[model samples]
Target: MTPEDRFPGPEHPDSGPRHQPDLDVLPYGTYYEPEPAGYAEAAYGSETYSGYGGARYLEQHWPATGQAHNVHDQQAAHPGYEPTLPDRPSPVHQGDDPPTIELGPPLAEPVPAYPYPAPGPDEPVGPLYVVGDVHGYLEELRAELRHQGLIDADGHWAAGRSRIWFLGDFTDRGPDGIGVIDLVMQLAAEAAAAGGYCRALMGNHELLFLGAARYGDEPVQSTAGTASFLAAWRLNGGQQHDLDRLEAHHISWLSRLPAIALEDGHLLLHSDTTAYLEYGESIPDVNDAVHDLLADEGVDEWWDCFRRFTKRFAFRGDAGPQAVHELLDAYGGSRVVHGHSPIPYLTGTVHADDGAPPHIPGPYIYADDLAVAMDGGVTMEGRLLVARLPI
Candidate 1:
């Protein structure tokens, strides 16, 4: 697709608004919100595939990756780049407040009086929750997580031993992305202390934000001819404030994040793609490879990681099931849970039947139940999904 095609507008004719796009930074990215008439197959991309369940085939190239280095090595190489994370991390400079983000409603599902069956004398307690994309919508995240009883009244981790995994995109687009990252970093420490853990999976946005901060406007060879990391990031809603506040610790944290994870027999990833296999045969190797790439200063290597990762919908069409099976077969997981491409994009509804932007009642299960999508379209006025795992 052409740049205009990827981000189409009415004046552009080729694209129409399909869903109220969930963008981290508001307004720059979305162009298609489907009218009552819906859309033709080719309009979405070079694809053809249907929705979940019995497929007429609504083709979904699909979801799209990062690089080299230890922090000490990076600091030595860059000169004058000292990033010692403060005990309390805060990067938003005073007087540089970002624009207010209008976060949407919280994602809620009917809960039983008790979340799980009461444990027998021998039963050990278990509660696993996965949060979808939080593109700098910190308050929304805090409110939504609190509702799930994960955090306490003071916004501290309170879920004792339950696991909470955040599927990346913690910064950029919306205001206070750094704040969100700070909270997660803090919670990870807190959660670990409580015998539970709050871990994160890396998302493409994390890659984009890092790239823009490091490379910014430097031309890189891409599948779509010459493009700069900065242009692509800003076009996709990279906020100036986030970029300004972007720090060494944030960069290091993002670089170290694993692209793939496993929990409760489910394969957790930030995007629904088979790209992880290219990094390594195993999860540890993949994370290591990405870390190495981030630490390195090569522009092309960074761009390659960024470009390869921008791909999405790999597991969505006639070949989607096989694609999923391949990832599972290689990764050793029965299911794939991911965030990146929002569900509204696949279903093509910005608004519900009631004229409200449709909220995902739950993670979208597709690819013959091999995958679950957690991005609830929070950036688009949809619910910010925080659902328990194995659903």
Candidate 2:
């Protein structure tokens, strides 16, 4: 099928408001410009897809796959200049307050009971639960949540009055990413309704999926001036089924998701990179910066923002503490809880026995109490993690 035939159009009942394009459909990257300010405002102002009843939205906005100009092309176009480093702003003089961001209005009023499942009368309330990266694998995700008593036998949420934070990467690389996202969206709504809340951070995959859906075959001249979303998606494991489910509304919701959130005293982010410091001084500012980038559809700078945000493994060894320190100093959190880097890699298990695949069963505490690597490599033969937080 042709690209047009493959993508079709929005499938969700709630497509929300639509807009006319200034230019006609062009091959990806034909009209490269900075995204307009109105783009962000329009994209984020819609109803969120999170909540138990919003599975349709999840299915409609799933990730897509394809090949475009390759990253090698990006490098070839750039020659010697590095494209990964972020553009830096002029250094501010000392004594200036590192930028401050006003956290948005309280998400919603807390409910009386937990939305998913109330804890047993005799069971102690779990401190807080943080799940690792669930790259699809809905069955594994369900099993892990059930193992933690976060859900019941019926596959419904059951953790009442307890908070749960998903470290992101809910989709991609495995079957049923859409299902996993749908469940999380629903649990977030249910938890909020129940006085507790279920929250997630944005992973690079989320950004990739959002870009592929919004831009599709539309090419954006990368910093290298030749790369496009089509190329990026293929490198990143974009799936055809995900593209079939893409919708404008889902893109809007994913674009608005926060890049980082602090729970209790733990800092939660999708990747271990300290590049968040480049956006703003605090968590809120960083998130806003990310949202601002997602909203600007035309600007090549938006792609640059995404490219920088996608870098991972920044917190592996010597740089790990420094990276954690930057976030801790800015976000006022004691520990940085993150996904993106799988636990097996973080724990140095990449070269396990020949037949035994790397296994990261649940949330992993790392960095000598400074960081937590949550991606359990569920996309592999490992387990999906759902653990009590504040451990």
Which candidate should be chosen as best, given lDDT against the real structure?
Answer: 1
lDDT of 1 at 180: 93
Tell me the spans in candidate 2 whose CA falls farther than 4 Å from its real position. Answer: 1-126, 223-225, 297-299
lDDT of 2 by residue, 259-355 (tens): 8888778888887777677789877788888887777546356555566556555554444566677678988889887877655444544334564
Q: Cα miss at 308, model 1 (Å)?
A: 1.6
Query: lDDT for each of the candidates?
Result: 0.61, 0.55
Predicted structure 1: clash tally: 38
**Regions of candidate 1 where Cα sits further than 4 Å from its true position:** 1-125, 351-355
Q: Determine the C-alpha RMSD for candidate 2 after optimal superposition of all C-alphas.
A: 17.4
How far out, in Å, is residue 365 in model 2?
3.0
Q: RMSD, each candidate, Å?
A: 15.8, 17.4
